[model samples]
Target chain A: MNKNEIDNANKYLSKFARLTRNVLDEKELISLSQEKTLLDDYLQMEQLRFGFKYEINHSEDLDLENIEIPSMLLQPFVENAVKHGISKKATDGKINITFIKKANDLALTVTDNGNGFDTEKKNNGLGLLLSESRVALLNSIYKENRFTLAIQSATNGTKVSLTLSDWL
Target chain B: MRAILIDDEISNLENLRTLLEKHCPKVTIMATAQSVSAAVDAIEKYLPDLVFLDIQMGEQTGFDVLKLLPRRNFEVIFVTAYDQYGIQAVKFAALDYLLKPIDIEELINAVNKAEYKLATQIQTSQLDFLLQQLKKTDTHVSTIAIQMQSETRYVTLSEIIRCEADNTYTYFFLANSEKILVSKSLKEYADLLRPNGFLRTHQSHLVNPKYVKSWLKEDGGILLLTSGEKIPVSKPNKETVKQALQRQ
Candidate 1:
């Protein structure tokens, strides 16, 4: 095999292994600082494969560094946006992430400027379905309907927002 | 022994050739094919004694080639990455196969097994049995029926605490101090119960994960079950047993 082909194969294997590890590494919750660190690492990995700009915006009111949230909570939405939203578009795209501490809840919004999909359709794929189910499970585990996911899409772009009610 | 290598990837074919050359000197490399049609042509032309075949070859499957073969005259060693539902069938029939990212030891072992089986009379009915088992396992059923002398018995997989091998018969220990014996090998039940959270703790025992209360890690290992029964874990199976316990 040529050097380029071998390199590509090795790269794909490493990427696959990393993603599989991430998926299988399950826990109930993680500290907000640790979650941010993981998201940073994941963003670095995704940037290598998808040509899109990733931005992080957080509110100044809350101390997120010491907080804890459900495991694998926010990563899947970013992954879905990159895979279904930006990757399919013709030209360059941007993913805007916002972490807002509301009065009664902490909300995360992932907005992508690419081809918007039908929010009602289940077939946009497993990422959304899995994320929704995971959030529901987290809520059930917490013994309250505290976690909620909202997905909204327009013709120009799509937005997915997740809120943890009375989030700590 | 003449062998033909069939895989869609050239690199895998070359690697297998090297492995066979170094590990199995008794076998001669006859030819190689990279696709289903090519594999069929090579098999017909060379009439090899053994065929090291890959399961997936792009659009065509290795089964297609196996079906087109004039007769089941040669031994086949399947090489594949993913097992899915096919491996249960393969193991059920006692056929030889090597998982990819192949190990030299497994390669030698599978070749030796193929040789031993080829020397004896091959049963074509095993394939049919495997297909039947595959059909049954395709559904997401949690219960398995065991046949006794007069009538067939049924038990949910979760109801059984463990299975113990008594020669060809298997004894199922249930939660309510009930014991039932069935006329089937432990290997068959092991293959069936494996995907259902039952870990084969020893050659004679397969313990359910939910029923395992504790592991006494001395004398190989012993699992303390919820039913107050302790099952002995084999030496090599100790680490796996520990990992599974930790996961639980």
Candidate 2:
């Protein structure tokens, strides 16, 4: 992106960050999965432009016992997916976000059916790198291997999975 | 009535001091603090009965000062710059606070009331209860006191139509065609009403449980109220409506 385009994108991302903070601050009692979905849907609506669908499906009894993470960790990831994954495609797109608890971890998977890219390469842009760093921070709070970040891209789509320590 | 004036601006500090001294002679100006550290130290050392606090001083707010102190012994009269919304918040809090360019008459009145209340030995417990209720008003279901002309009425949590926030006032729309202006914010009312079956379906609107006729899912979602007024539903609160409807 050029200077003006980069500046505009930065402004929009900052706005998303601010709105996320406002929503979190105003909400008194938010569960972990609920908070994550809130950030995800906010980014999906605010960042995407075309025919994109965002769905958050989670079963009841999700482990959310007094677990609170940073305010806007998922927004950047969602933004990265929309900007790089879906925006490059001409057809409609859909992002499915699912939260599930297994064994001793809380697992989240975000999958989108759009133009995929090479995940082996290190040039995942600042947004993706920032997302990686955030997951690393989440790892620091939980133990090593308590947090996992995985990205895979096929010919038609991309899937990103994150697993954080089960605090419940 | 002992008080402390804390503000970075010399002119504002001096102006407030003059106003307090002239109009509220009973309120003794114990000391003044310009910075956060100085203010904290003075508050600890002098322990004034009240503090005429400026919200903005360099980078810190009056709330920061309150957070730093272990326990607030004195009451606060927050002197803000131009946040009428914040002023309304303070009013809703029922804690005595004043706005800047401190009006002499208003300052005197506030200080006098504080003096009278203090002299009466009004239970700190009661004052604390009021303060607690005020803070909870921002996020809990609260019975708003409304006065219309000669008649006074309080529209309960279930009778509210919607609340519109306009600067310092929130206009509460009732089931009847009457709108009562309360000195609070939409968020405050939402907090007060959330547990009482009121959902903040819109950023600017809060709906009672008995009023939602149907939900319309279009581009975003909208709620058709019993009065046929269409209110936009905030995406975050869609599930809240569903949950509420299920319980109903």
Candidate 3:
């Protein structure tokens, strides 16, 4: 293998190790910055694996280091997009993640350009199911700011958005 | 020892090759296949002593390849990335599996285990158990392979009443009043058993809802089991435990 490829591989290994460590951590909550770092590591590793087949973009409008949310709240949704959406597409797949401050709510969304699932049908995907329960668990823990999830899909693409009401 | 690598993804196969070359020098890679048909062909031709099999291919799985080769003359180690069902089946058989972005130490350990099993010519019943598990659609009827210090025990889910965490180890409390100590954390088993009606009522206690006799609301909540054991339920999980019990 080329030295560049080896370097990329090493980076992938270290990032993956950190991701595993973060996931296995027993902590219930983490900062927005820490969560972003987790997603950054995860997406970077995926980029190494998939290379130029897909593109990912990120945008945020919040104090990442100060605001805190439930740990691993967004990972499953991104994983769902990668596994069910872009991975199956032939080429030129795109994923966009946005974190926005809307009034008293925090809005996080992940959109992907791939074959989307039927919005009317109940998704039985394991990642989706796990995240659904996780949201419920979080709602139980922090009953103040109710967390709501909305998913929209069509044949061309899919978008998943989560709104933490009165969180900001 | 000779080995064959089978993965639909070229990069993963490459990664495995690099790790094997760097860490496991005792084994020789005879062939690599990317699809089920190719894997079957390579295995038939090479007749490898060991195989590193990927769980998911295009439309088929590695189990399909295993099914085609009925004769059990080779050792197998499964490699996959976040395949819950596949990993569950493999774990239930006490088989070795490496998750991708594969850890070098885990890869080395799996290789060493495969090498030793091949050398000893030990007939593994794990494959048969795994195949049986895959055949069964209902997980409730399936048996769980519990790895102990000296031997692996296969027991059904209903047989286990609860699990208690002791630091890095977990103790399995069975309905037969027998206890088995496993070297894995409570969190791991909690993940595996969550879908099967097990409740994580506390950080240190995982209870099977089937064995719950009654819920005691006093003393910060406790579950009375059919086995006459009182399992403590934590404050946060009390609501969940109550809901789960109500659903039963």
| Number of the top-ranking candidate, with TM-score as the measure | 3
Q: In candidate 1, which residue pairs get closer than 3 Å at backbone N, Cα or C atoms, i.e. clash? A: none
lDDT of each: 0.72, 0.65, 0.80
- Candidate 1 Cα misplacement greater than 4 A, ranges: A1-168, B121-124, B131-137, B140-191, B194-204, B207-248
Worst 10 residues of 3 chain A by lDDT: A51-60
* DockQ-based CAPRI category assigned to the predicted complex of candidate 2: incorrect
Task: Evaluate model 2: give its lDDT.
Answer: 0.65
TM (chain A) per model: 0.80, 0.71, 0.88
RMSD in order of candidates: 15.0, 16.0, 11.7
Per-residue CA lDDT of model 3 for B66-148, tens digit only, reads 98887758989998876464777887677888877786767788888777777766665677778888888776545788866
- Deviation of model 2 at B107, angstroms: 32
Q: List the residue pairs that clash in candidate 2.
A: B139-B191, B140-B191, B140-B192, B141-B192, B141-B193
Query: Superposing every Cα of model 1 onto the true structure, what RMSD results?
Result: 15.0
Sort all candidates by lDDT, best to worst: 3, 1, 2
Clashes of each: 0, 5, 0
